[model samples]
Target: MTTTPGAADWRAANLANWDERVPIHTAGSFYDLPAFVAGRNTLRDFELSEVGDVAGKTLLHLQCHIGLDTLSWSRRGATVTGLDFSAVAVKAANGLAAQVDATTARFVTADVYDAVQALGGQRFDIVYTGFGALCWLGDIARWARTAAALVAEGGFLYLAEYHPVADLLGDDGATVENDYFHRDPIVVDAPGTYADASAPMAATVTVEWRHGIGDVVSALTAAGLRIEFLHEHDHSHFRLPAGKGIPQVYSLRAAKTA
Candidate 1:
C-alpha cells in the first residue's frame, strides 16, 4: 500500500499503487467513458494520422492504463493487446472490452520491463505507448529495447507523449521550475493520488524519473529501430503550466529494419 524510499523498493510500490489506481481511473471523469462509447477517439489527431491504417494489423499497446485506447484500436479492425503493470488495470480493461463487445482486444498484466518474458514470444505490427507513460519508467534505453523487440520486421513503434520541454517547467502555476535533463529520481511525499484527487490516500512517498528528447530518440535508434518521423505539436491532453502554455503531443515513429 505504501512505497519505500529506495529505488528498487519504489518501483514495486509504484506498481502496486498503480494497480490500485486502475479501477478508480476506470470510473473517473477524466477518461469520459460516455464520450468514448459515442465513437470518440481518445487518441490525438497527430497520433491517429501517423500510425495510420491498423486494419488487419496486430497491435500492442504498452502501459495501457484501462485500455480505452487499446479497445479503440480494436474497433478500427486491429487485433489489439493491451499490457499494463497493474493487475487491476488489466482486469478493468478486460471488463470494459467485454462490455464494449471488443472481443478482439486482450489485456495482460506485467511490468513493461518484463513484458517480453511474461508475454512469451508475441510480436505485433505496431508497438504503441502514449502520454504520461514514459515518465514512470526509470530506464529509457531498456524500455525502447523492449518495445523494439516486440515489433515484427516492417512493423513500427508509435508514441505520443508529453513533451519533455514542457516537463522542465514545474507545476508551480508560475514560472519554469524543473530541469530539462534527466535528474536524480524524483521523490514526492504526498497524501493523495493523481487519479483520485478527492480520495484520502495514505501519506505515501513516490519516485519518478525524467527522460529527455535525445534520450528517447537515441534509445530507440540503438534498439535497431529506424526513425521514420518525429512530430511535435502544441496541444496536450491536459493543461501543463502557465507561461509554457498548454503542452503539445510529440508523435514519434520508429520502424524495425530488416
Candidate 2:
C-alpha cells in the first residue's frame, strides 16, 4: 500500500489525467448529455432499488464526474451535492445543471480526502459513490472513513463498483491480468479510457489501486458503519460485455446506525 505521503504523486497524476478527460467524457455518447438534459436519469435500474427512495433525502455523490448521475438524484427529489477532484469536471457538471434548469443539484471541486471541509460541514442522508471510483484511491481505509464522516447519523452509504474480479481481467475482458487480493497501486500509462476506448487521450499515465469486496466491507466496518448487505451482479455500466457467467459488478449498502 502506498503510504499517505507517497500517494500524493500518484493522486496528482490521476487528478490531472481525469481533468483532461472531462470534455471528452461530456462529449461522448456514453455519457448521453442530451438525454440528461431531456430529463433522463443516468442511474441504472438496480441502483434505484438498492438506494430506495431519495425523495426528500440529502445525497452526496463522491467522485461524481460532470454531475449527470448526481443531477438524476436531484430529479428524484434529493438535495444533491456532487463532488469531484477535477475542476473541469465540476465546471461542466454545473453547466449541465444550468442547461437542464435543475435547481436542487450543486457541484464541488475537491479531493475525496478534503470533502468534509470542502462541503462546509454539511452531512447527508446518503453518501453515494458509483462505478469506477474506488480504484483511483490508494487508501480505502481513509476513503471509507471519510464516507462515514459524510453520512448523517441515521443515513447510509450506497456504493456500486466494478468488481475486483472484473478489474483483474485484461483488455479482452476475459484473461486474468492481475491479482485480486493485492492491496497495492498498479501504475498504468495507457492511451484509451473505459468510456470511449478509441478517443485520443492527452493524459495517458495513471495509477490505480485494487480492492476486493472483502476489503470494502472491512474498511467500512472499521470506520464504524454497519454492514447492511452486499450483492454481486453480472452487468456493468460500460458497453463491454461482462464476460459470460462472470460477476462484473458489486453493490454495497452500509449504514451509520448510531
Candidate 3:
C-alpha cells in the first residue's frame, strides 16, 4: 500500500511499527541498554557542547524513544521529561529512569502534536528533539509550532538529525536514489527494525517524510524561533559511506529571544 503524507492510516502504521520495535530496540546492541543503565551517556559530544550546562534547567524531549537521551540529559542535572507516542517505549523509559535513579526524569506517552496539552501547557527551558525524528512527522511546520509553543521564553530548541541528503544517496552512497525535495510520505514495507535488521518484525509497513534543511529552518522561523546555528557534520550513528564527505548528520539550535 502506498501511504500518502498526513494520512491518518500512515500515522497508525508508523506507530504500530514503532511499538513493535520497542522490545527489539531495547534488546539489541544498537541502543546498548545495559551500558546505558550502567551510566553510559548516549548523547553525542556536539550535542553536549551545543546544549551546554543543562544543570537546573527544565527540558522537554519530543519523540524520545525509550528516554535514553532524556535520562542522559537528566544525569547532566536537567529536569527532563520525555514524550513518545509508544506507550511500551514510555514504560521502558520510566523503568530505565528508575534503574538509574534519575530523580528528575519522567516519561509520558503521547504523540508529538499533543505534547503541549499532554504536559498541561507547561513550557520548558529547552525543547530537544531529532536523531531520525523529523522524517517521522508528516507536517514539519506543525511540528515547529508545537515545539515552539513548548519552549519557555529565553529558552531554545535543539535538533540533532540525520541529514536528508543521506536519503538521496543509494546503498553505494555515491548514487542519487531518493528525491530530497519529495514532500510526500516515503513508504517502506519491509521486515525488521533498524536496531536489529535480522530480527523478525510484525508491523513491517512504515511511512516517512523528507524535510530539507531549508524546510526545517523556515518552519522554525515561521514559528517565531530565531535560528542560532545550523551545523552539518561528517559523522553519524549509522554507517554512512566514508570518504564521500557528504553531511551524515546536522544540528540546529533555534532560540526564543522573548
lDDT of each: 0.82, 0.87, 0.91
The model with the greater lDDT, 1 or 3, is: 3
Error of 2 at 73 (Å): 0.6
Candidate 3 wrongly placed segments (more than 4 Å) = 241-243
Candidate 2 off by > 4 Å: 1-5, 171-173, 237-239
What does candidate 1's lDDT look like per residue over 1-258, in tens digits? Answer: 233357678787677667666656767777877777767788766677889989999999999988988988898899999999888888888988887899788999888998898879899999999889998888899999999999999999999898877766555534667777645678776655665667555536567788888899999999999999988776743655324454546888999989
User: Which one is best on lDDT?
Assistant: 3
Ranking by TM-score: 3, 2, 1
lDDT ranking from best candidate downward: 3, 2, 1
lDDT of 2 by residue, 33-105 (tens): 8877998878888999999999999999999988888998988989999999999999999999899877988
Which prediction has more favorable TM-score, 2 or 3? 3
TM-score of 3: 0.97
> In lDDT terms, how accurate is model 3?
0.91
- C-alpha RMSD by candidate, in order: 2.8, 2.2, 1.4
In candidate 1, which residue pairs get closer than 3 Å at backbone N, Cα or C atoms, i.e. clash? 236-247
Model 3 over residues 178-221: C-alpha lDDT tens digits?
77777877889999977788889889999888899999999999
